[model samples]
Each structure stands twice: as C-alpha cells, then as structure tokens.
Target: MEVDYVVVGGGSAGCVLAARLSEDPAVQVALLEAGPPDASVLIHCPAGLALLAKNGQANWGFETVPQPGLGGRRGYQPRGKVLGGSSSVNAMIYARGHHADYDAWAAEGNAGWSWDEVLPYFRKAEHNERGADAWHGSGGPLNVMDLRSPHRFGPIFVQAGMQAGFRENRDFNGAEQEGVGLFQVTHRNGERCSAAKAYLTPHLARPNLHVVTGAHATRILFDGRRAVGVAYRHERTIQSVKARREVLLSAGALLSPQLLMLSGVGPAAHLQEHGIPVLHDLPGVGRNLHDHIDVVQVVEAPHLTDLFGLSPRGIANALKGIVEWRRHRSGLLTTNFAEAGGFIKSDPAEPLPDLQLHFVIGKLMDHGRQTVWGHGYSCHVCLLRPRSRGSLLLASKDPLAPPRIDPNFLADADDLRRLVRGFRVMRDILAQPVLAAFRGREQAASAAAVSDEQVERFIRGHADTIYHPVGSCRMGSGPLDVVDAQLRVHGMQGLRVVDASIMPSIVGGNTNAPVIMIGEKAADLVKAAREPVHATREAVAA
Candidate 1:
C-alpha cells in the first residue's frame, strides 16, 4: 500500500501525527502498530492498568542489561506495544514537567522548543474538564480531568505532606510544579482517554487515514539518504508500504532508536559489527539514554480493606468494582493506582523540585510485577533529574530481538545522595500525625535501613526506573544529537521522530503529557514544511 505518510507505531505521537496530518483530506496517512488494537476492556477502564502491569499482553516487558550501579540487577522496562503506546497502560497522571525542561532543550541549540514556544501546542492538544485557563485549553482532543473515584487516602497523603511542611498544589501543570495533591488524569467520565482514543480512534473513519494493527515494523526502507517507506511483518508474512512524502518514526524512546540502528542508520561501527551495511553514520542514534531512578517505601496495613491487594477482601472488592464500573463507570474501578503524588526538592536550597513522589494505594514492588500479599500502600520517590546516562545497543542483527538497554542507574554519586535525602523526606511524611492512622509497619528492609550507609545499600539493592525513558534519539545540533529542532533526523531526509526519544533530558514529571505535546507541535512542523513545496507546485501548474 502507498500513502502520503507512513507512520510507524500507533502510539501517542504516531496517533497524533496520523490524525493531524490527515486533517487535510487531500493527504493520505497510514499508521502501523506492532501490537493488537486498543480494543480490550482492560485498556479503557482506568483500574485495568494494574492487571495489565502484571501481564505481558500489550506490553513490551523489556529488561535492561545488569547495571553495576544497582549492584548488577537487571531493571524491568515495560513499554506499551499496542496502539496509544505507554499512555494506554500508564497511571494516567497528566503532567508537563518543569518549564525549565523545555528551556534546556532550547538552550541546547534546538529552536522552537522553549517552554514559552511549546506551551501553545500543549494547550492545543488538551480539553481539560475544568475548562480553559492561562495555562490550559478547552474543546481539544485529549481530555484531562480530575479523578472521579479518587481514593480517600489521596487527601490523607496530601495532609501528611502539609504536616511535613510542604504546601498543597492543586495543579502541578499550573504556574508551579511544587507541593502535593491528587493528580488530574487523562480520563473522560471515569474511563481512560488514551492518545488513541483522543487523537486516532475518532479519526479512524476518515477516508484519508488507514490504521493497521499487528504489524511489526522491521526496518525503514531508504532510497539514498531519504526514508522512502517501511518494511514490516504481518501475519507471518513480510509486507512493504510506500510513503509518498515521508516516513514518520514515532516508535518511542527505546524502539525508535533500535529501529534506526536496525535500518543501518545508527552508529556505523556498531551496525557493521552486527553484519549490517551502514546507510548513515549517525553515532548518536542510540546514545544519551536516561530515566528516572525510583525507589519505593512500602507499609503493610491489613486493616485498610480499601487498599488494593491479593487478600480475599481485596478480590471481592475488585469484583464489586467491576460491576459498578460497568454500570456507571464509577467506584473503585476508576482508580489510577498512583492517584496522589507531588514534586518537591530534596533540599529547600535547590532551585527546582528535584524529587517526585507517587503514593499508591497498594503494595507495589518491582513495577507491581512481584506479588506481595497484603492490604497496604506504597510511596515512590524518584530522582527527577539524574546526572547518570546510559545507552541502547542492538543485541543482534535480527530485528525481532530486544535491544541491549543499559540505564546506568546511579552512576553519579550525587544521584544516590539525592535519593537518600528524598527517601528520608518521604519517611518523615509517612510518619506525620495525619497519616499515623493509615500508616502501618514499614517494610522490613526499609525499616531496618536507618543510617545513610544503610539507605545507600538499600537503594542499590532495590532501586529501579519509574518507567520514563528518553534521550536515545535526542534533538539538538550536537555531534551526539539524532534529530534537529524540526525533529528530523540529522543528515537524513523524509524522516522525523516525534516522541519522548527526542527529549534532550528527562522531564521532572510524568512523560506522557509531554510526549503528546511533542506530537501536537511536530504535526504543525510537518505541515509547515510541506506548505512551501505545495505552493511551488501550484505556481508551476498555474
């Protein structure tokens, strides 16, 4: 099949690209997804994320190479493989990170990405339930709303923060990002409004747009230095689709770089080692990978039956929640586990909040993969901006194999020190009188760790990613940069990467919202570039 644009990956950015580009009915767009469609009931219901987290269905479930910083433990990296990407299986928290994050991008020689410039695109993509404001928008595709069934413990968590001397912030994406409060989610009437739901689903019927699921893109087909099309696998058969104008790669932070390397567009030496012919000698294709290193503090509270767990009471409550949700789209089923969270600085002297906290109404260990039987709650404290960096390399020449991921967690001594301070601060909040009623016996490992040395050991033993990875295909003008200010791959034509991968640095909050905003702005950039050519064509015809 052939189209004006062939978008590889029907994730958050790809969905946005397909929808926005197809707006001009004159243009034809095709979106290819490696996983199944987002048709599962588990995908639409907000609480279904927990079940999705435990299983590999619709999840890449990628594991990182054992890191020396974490005492040689392999970290779990779960990315959404289905449509809407990770946004379909995430906590649904809507955050844009600190304003300085975008400014940092602009400072790195990437024009049109500063906070002041990108804020409009953010507003253009949002349809907040609270309506328009100086910082938010209304009547947009992506819906952002307050949780309909927020857990009672959410307020308690905030009160504990206040008691611990932190102010309460009702909106994290507002004028400031500090303080604690319940998170606004990407929901509409209690149901998940994933990127696919907002940007792609409603546009699927457009005659100019085509969406194909279960298509694993193996490589980008290039003609000379320009991306001409995409070659993928569908139903055990190899298939190729041509792109008349451009091939937009929105395969995400990890896969986007992997695909580039697989197509022989990455580090030439690495590609040659895997017996692949080099097409482009971009050394930065898979470099500069980093993520938020997080550690959780668990407290067992069997008395709190409302908390999610494996207990009989918890199971019964879940069943009841399902019924209530199916009937009215309300009740416990609407809960996004990390319902309440905040951004704070480990030390008051820090210019910005360097730490982010997520209060889960359940025992979450190992990204909720390991089962801990009990009714309890957990708090996650992550270093928002780690100095540590890592890289992604091809494991083999085969495109089907997973890439070798090394996050190099805590490679910097300062990252560990800040985490220690963040842990102590979280422990203090949990100890506040307001939470004394809900708090229970601290997890044995955490309770035993009192001294700074003990805390450092604990972090090395248990710290992992909070699931935000970026910079693999960063946008800048540096020798190590992959894409430019327009998001086009450096030294490559008819290609652009519109996802978290382009972020020069990890943001200080959840990445989903920022990625969606990238999609919004990228769509405009793509269209603006095409306008001049279209004008030239019209003039020639006249």
Candidate 2:
C-alpha cells in the first residue's frame, strides 16, 4: 500500500500524528500497530491497572538483561502493545514536566524546542477541566480533568504536604509547577481517555486515515540515503508499505531506536556484526538511554482504607459506582490510580522540583498485581533528573525480538545521591502529623544503620525505574545526535522519529502527556514542511 505518510506505532504520539496529519483531508495517512485493539475493560477502569501487566493481552511484557548496577537482576519493563500503547494502561496522571527540562533541549542545539515554543502545542492539544487560559486549553482533543471523587486520604495528603513545608498548587501544568496537590488525570466523563480515544477515535472515519492493527513494522525501507517506506509483518506474512512523503516512526523509546538499528540506521560496527548492512552511520542512534529510577517506600497502614482492603463487598458496591459514573459522570471508577502527588527539589536553589512523587492508596507492588495480598500506604519517589546514562542495542536482527535495555541506573554517583534525597523527602512527608495517623510500620526492612553510606547501600539494593525511558535516539545537531530538532533523522531524508526515543532528555514527570505533545508538534512540523510557500503565505495573511 502507498500513502502520503506511513506512521509506525499507534501509541500516544503516533495516534496524535495520524489524527492531525489526516486533518488536511487531502493527505492519506496510515497508522500501523503491532498489538490488538484496545477494548480491554481493564484499560477503561482506573482500578484495573494492576491486571493489565503480565496479562499478555495489552502489554509487550519485555524483560531487560540483568543489570550489573542493579545487582544482576533482570528488570521487567512493560510497554503497552494495544492501540493506545502505554497510555492506555498507565496511571493517567497528566504532567507536562518542568520548564527547564524543555529549555535544556533547546540549549542542547535543538533550536525551536524551548519551553516557550513547546507550551503552545501542549495547550493546543489539551481540553483541561480547569478551563482555557494561557497555560491550558478547553477545546483540544486530549482531555485533562480534575479528579471527580478523590480518595478519602487525598486532602489529608495535601494538608500533610503543606505541613511539611511544600506549597500547594492546584494545577501542576499551570504557570508555575511547584507544590503538593491533587493530580489532574486524562479522562473524559468517567472513562480512561487515552490518546487513541482522544485523537484517533474521533478521526478514524476519515477516508484519508487508515488504522491497521496487529501489523508490526520490521524495518525502514531505504532508497539510498532517503527512507522511502517500511516493511512490516502481519498474519505470518511480511508486507511493505511505501510513504510518498515521509515514513514517520513513533515506535517509542525501546522499539524506535531498536528498529532503526535493525534497519542498519544505528551503530556501524554493531549492524555489521548482525549481518545487517549499514544504511546510516549514526553512532548515537541507540545511545544515551535515560530513565528515572524509583524506590517504592511501603508502610503498613492502621486502617483498611488502602487499595488492598477493598472487599468483595467493596467491588459489589462499586457496581453502584459504575452506575453513578455512567449516569452522573462521577464515581470511584473514574479515579486515576494515583490520587495525590507533587514535585520537590532536593536542592532549594533549583527553580522547579527535581523529585516526582506519586501517592497511591493501593498496595500496588511487583509491577502492579504480581502479588497483592498485603495492605499498605505507598509513596514512590522518582528523581526527575538523573546523571545516569544507558543504551539500547539490537539483541538480534529479528524485529520480533525485544531490544537490550540497559538503563545503567545508579551507575553514576549523582543518581544515587538524588534518589537518597528523594527517599528522605518521602520520609519527611510521611512524618507530618496528618500522615502519622495512618503510618503503621516500615515494610521494606532497612538494610543497615541510618548513615549516608547505609542509605546508599539501601538505594543500590532497592532502586528501580519509574518507567520514564528516553534519549535512546537523542535529538540534537551534533555528531552524537541521531535526529534533528524537527525529529528527522540526522542524515536521512523522509524519515522522522516522533516519540519518546527522540527526547534529548526525559521530562520531569510521567511521559504520556509529553509524548502526545510530541506527536501534535510533529504533525505541525511535517505539515509546514510539505506546504507550498505561496499557500503558507496565504494562510499567514488570512
């Protein structure tokens, strides 16, 4: 099949790209997704996040090679394979990240990507519940809603935060993002609103758009130095689709860079080693991997108000919740797994919070529902900025095989220091009198005495990723950069990566909103590039 644009992966970014690019009505866009349709009930229910992982129905369930830094234990990295990808199964918290994070991208030779430039796209894609303003939008495709029925502990958590010296900000995505408060979730009505639901669902009927599920993009088909199309596998057969204008890759951090490498667009020697002849000699295609490392500090709770204690009776009561949500558009089912969270900077001098905290009223552990017999109060702390770097490499030439993900977490001394500070921050928050009422006892046993060295040891033993992976295909203008500011591969034409992979650095918070924004902005850039000069002049004049 041939089209104007062939978008690989229908995740948060790809969904937005396909939706926006097809808006012209004259252009043809095809979105290819390897996973099945995203109709799973678990995806729509806020409390169902635990069931999605390891179920094989919604997730890729990729496991990483045992990291030496993480004590030779292989980590489980779950990426959603269904229509909306990770956004479908995520906690649904909406965060745009700190301003400095985007400004740093522009400073690192990626012009036109400063926070000032990116914020408009963020607004343009959001339909925030808090109403429209300079910082938010009310008519955008993506839905951002204030929590309708917060957990009983939500307000107490905020008050406790204030007692601990953290200011309270109603909107984290507003003018300034510092302080403790209720999180805004990606929901429309009372259902989980993923990018697919917000962007692609509304545009699927367009004759200009074609969405193909269960089709996995295998490799980029190159015509000399230009990317012409893609080869994919579906129903045990390999098929090829050509893009007349461009082959945009939104395959995400793990797969996009890995696919580029598989297609010989990565490290020269590594591609040759796998018998894949080199197409582009970009040494940084799969380098500079980064992700937030988090340690879940669990404490036993006095009351059964936590997620675990909800009875069979509670689930039965939830039927009333379902009816209430279906009728009034408000209930317990609408809850985003995280009811409360905030940001804090370890160094007081920093402009914005460097630590991201997620407060959960559930006993979510072992990647959510691997085991759930215990009742607890859990607050996870993830260092927003880590000095650690990792890499993504082709495990084999086969596209079916998952890539080797070495986050190399805690390899840097600074990352260890930051995580230690994050743990302390969580401790301080729990120490507040309001939270002290619920605090029971420490569940994760202390490794040693409470010295700095002992804390470092505990961190090394306990630290794991917060699931925010980026920088595998770092965007910039230097020899080490793989893609440019417009997300075009550094030396390749008609090929662009518009996903988490192209992030020069990971954002401060969850990646769903930022990844969706990348898709929106990418469509604009692609549209602008293909527009005729006279037409552009006419539009500007109009």
Candidate 3:
C-alpha cells in the first residue's frame, strides 16, 4: 500500500514520529514493527522490567563480539523488539541527560540542534509531574510521574547520598541534573507509559495511520539516490510498501545503521565484502558505536524484602492495587523499582556530572548473572560520559543476522581509571552509616576480599552495559558522518534518520528520554520540509 510516510520499526522513535506525522490527517503513515504487540502484562508493571530481559517475546537478545579489552567476554545486548521497543522493557527512568550534550552537537556543526533549539522538543514531549515550564511540559502524551510507592531501601540510598555530601534533587529533569533523587517514571497510573502507548496507541483510530505488527523491514526501496519505500517480511511472504513522499527509518541505534548498511548505504569496502552493490558508500553509517558500561557492587541485608518473594499474598495485594489503578488511577504498580538515582561529578572542576548512580532494592549481580537471596541495597556507578568509542559493522548482508558490535569498553586507560573512581565512590556510598544500617555484609566475590588491583580485576570481570547504546549513525558535518546537520542522510534524498543512532555523542545519562525528544523534533522537521513544497505548489496554482 502507498503511504505518505513509511516508518520502519515501531520502536521508541518510530512510534513518536508515526503518531505526530499522521496527526495532520492529510498524511498517511505506515508503522512497521518487527515484533509482536506490547499487550503483555509484564510491560505495564514497573517491577516486571527484569523479566523482559533476554526473553524471546519482546527482546531482540543481541550480543557483542567477545571484547578482547575486557578478558574476552561476549556482552549480552538486549534490545526491545516489541511495539514500544526497548522503552517498553526498560527501567522506565525518565532521564533527559545533560544540556551540554545537545550543545555539544551544535558545536560539532549540527546547526539548530543546540541545547536551546532542542530544549523545546524535550519540554514538548514530557508531561512532568511538576507541570509545564521552560524545562518541562504538561498535557503531553507521555506522562511523567514521581514514584507512587518507593521501595523501602530507596530512602536509605538517598540518605547515603546525603551523607556523602550530595544534595537531594526533587526532579532530575529540572534545574540542574547533579543530585540524588527519585526518578520520574514514564507511567500513567499503574501501567507503563511507553512511547508506543503515549504516542502511537491513541492515534491508531486515525484512518491515515496504519500500524503493521510482525512486519520486519528488510531493506530500503531506493530509486537511484532517493529512498522510495521499504521491502518488509510479514508471515512467510515478503511484502513491499511504497512511500509516496518519504521513507523514514527509525529502527534505532543498532538496526537502523544495519538496515542502511544492508541497503548499500554504509562503508563501501564492507558492502563489497557482503556482495551488495553500493548505493551511497557512507563510511560513517556504522563506524561510531558507544554505550554506557557499569559495574554492579552488591551487598546483603537480612531484613530486606525483594521482588522475588512477592507471591500469593503479595500478588493478592498487587491485584487489589491493580483494581485500584483501574478505578482510582493510583497504586504501588505506578512506580519503577530502581526508583532513585543521581549524577555526581567526581572532580570539582568538571562542568557537569560525570558519574551516574542507580540504587535498586534487589540483589543485582552482573546484570542478573548471580542470584543472592535476601533483600539487599545495590548501588552502581556508571561513567556517564566516556571518552572511549566503538564501532558496529556488518558481519554479513543477511537482515536477520546480528551486526558485529565492538563496544571497545575499557580500551582507554582513562575510562578504566574513571570507572575505578566510580567504584570507589560506590564503596563510599555503601560504607555510609545510613546504608550500613540495612546492610548485612558485602555479597560480591570481589567485595569479600578488597584490594585496588582485585577491584580493578573484578570490574573487568563484572562490568556490563547499562543498556544505553548510541552513535552508530553519527550526525555531524564531516566525510565520516552518516547524517547531516538537518538529520538528512548524507547522500540519500527523501530519507532521514531520527533515532539515537544519529547522536554524535552519547548523552550523560539514560538515552530513552532523548530518543523520544529526537522523534518529537524530527516530526517538526518533516512538517517544515513539507511546508516549502506545499507553498511552491500553492504559489504556482495562484
């Protein structure tokens, strides 16, 4: 079927763009999702995020090539494949990152994308609990609310941060972003308010907006230099969908660049190796890959209650609460489990916070690698802005085959040093009197016997990704850049990338909120581009 816009991937950014672009009523939009619908009960429940990891239903379950830098361990990279993408299964922490992040984009020749220009888009997408203002918005589709029933250990983590001399921030998305506080979650009542739920679901009734589930886009249908449409797979047959105006690819950081590469839009030599005819020869399509890596330091608590024990009686309470959510729109399910976090600058001279912290009530050992009983207060420190950079390249031309992800973590000595510093800070947080009150003892293998060298070795053994990946299709003004200042593909027409992949650099915090804002702003760009063409036609008619 022919549509005005064919959006590939019904993920976080695609959902937003599909919803906003179709709002005009004159535009026909087709949103293709590779996975099933996000109607699962676990999706809405904030505490259920852990279960979604590595699950075949909603997660993509992609892994990286063994990293030689990190003792040759192949990292498990789980991205959401369902309707809302990773945002559907993510921790639900509403972090917009540092203002300097956007400004850095502008400094790198991405005009009109400075912090000032992008701030409005961020504010536009958010319906904050604190109402509308210069930094936040209200009455938006995505609802941002404070945690309803914060975990018992949440406050202890906050107090520990206070003891460490950090201030308590009521809102991380407001004012300055450098304080410990409870995260604002993407929830409406007790259900998860993913981008798909907030942006796309309400607009599904529109005749112009067609949401195709279980349709996996294989490649871009290009006419010489312009992306004309997409060829996707649904059921057992391959189907082609034509875009009358434009084909927008929002397949996210990993898949978007992979699609571009598979469609002959990436590095020339690489494409030749795969026996695919080169279309654009854009070297930067998959050159710059980055992610936030974190090391989890877990400790034990005797009286602490964990999510695993929430059974029969606990589930009855949860059902009653769900009923309340259905009736009164308030309950315990409204909160994200990892309720509070913070951004701390390790050094005083730093312009912004370099270390990001997440405190969870459950025992987290190496991204759920180990199961330690009893409730525990776990605090982790992530080097928010890393100096290290990695790359993603095609292993083959096959669309279903996962790309080669080399997130060269700890390749740089500085990154290792910074992470060590971050671990030390976490140790300080754990040692504090308030947090110590709940702590029975250290539970980690490395923590049992302490040494700076052992801690470094443990970090190398235990550090895993924080699930925030960006910069595969970097946006800039350079020969290696995949997309330009206006987010247009470097050499293709009627095609643009508007996802986390376009980020020239990774943000200082979680990437979901920034990705949503990218969708919001890209919609404006699409409309603005259409305006000029419409004006020219009207002028000629007049």
Top candidate by TM-score: 1
Superposition error at 441 for model 1 (Å): 1.0
lDDT for residue 77 in candidate 1, whole number 0-100: 95
Write model 1 residue lDDT over 276-391, tens digit each, in one string: 99999999998999999999999989989889998899999999999999999999999999999899999999999999999999999888877788788999999999999999
Candidate 1 at 392: error in angstroms? 0.7
User: Tens digit of lDDT per residue, candidate 3, span 223-318?
Assistant: 777777788889977887777777788988889999998888988999999998998888888877989988877776645444332345445656
Total clashes, candidate 2?
Answer: 0
Error of 3 at 437 (Å): 1.5
Ranking by lDDT: 1, 2, 3
Listed in order, each prediction's TM-score against the native is 0.97, 0.94, 0.94
Clash totals for all candidate models: 0, 0, 0
lDDT of every predicted structure (CA atoms): 0.92, 0.83, 0.82
Decoy 2 TM-score against native: 0.94
Q: Candidate 3 at 301: error in angstroms?
A: 1.1
RMSD of each: 3.5, 4.9, 4.1
What range of 10 consecutive residues in model 2 has the weakest lDDT sum? 533-542
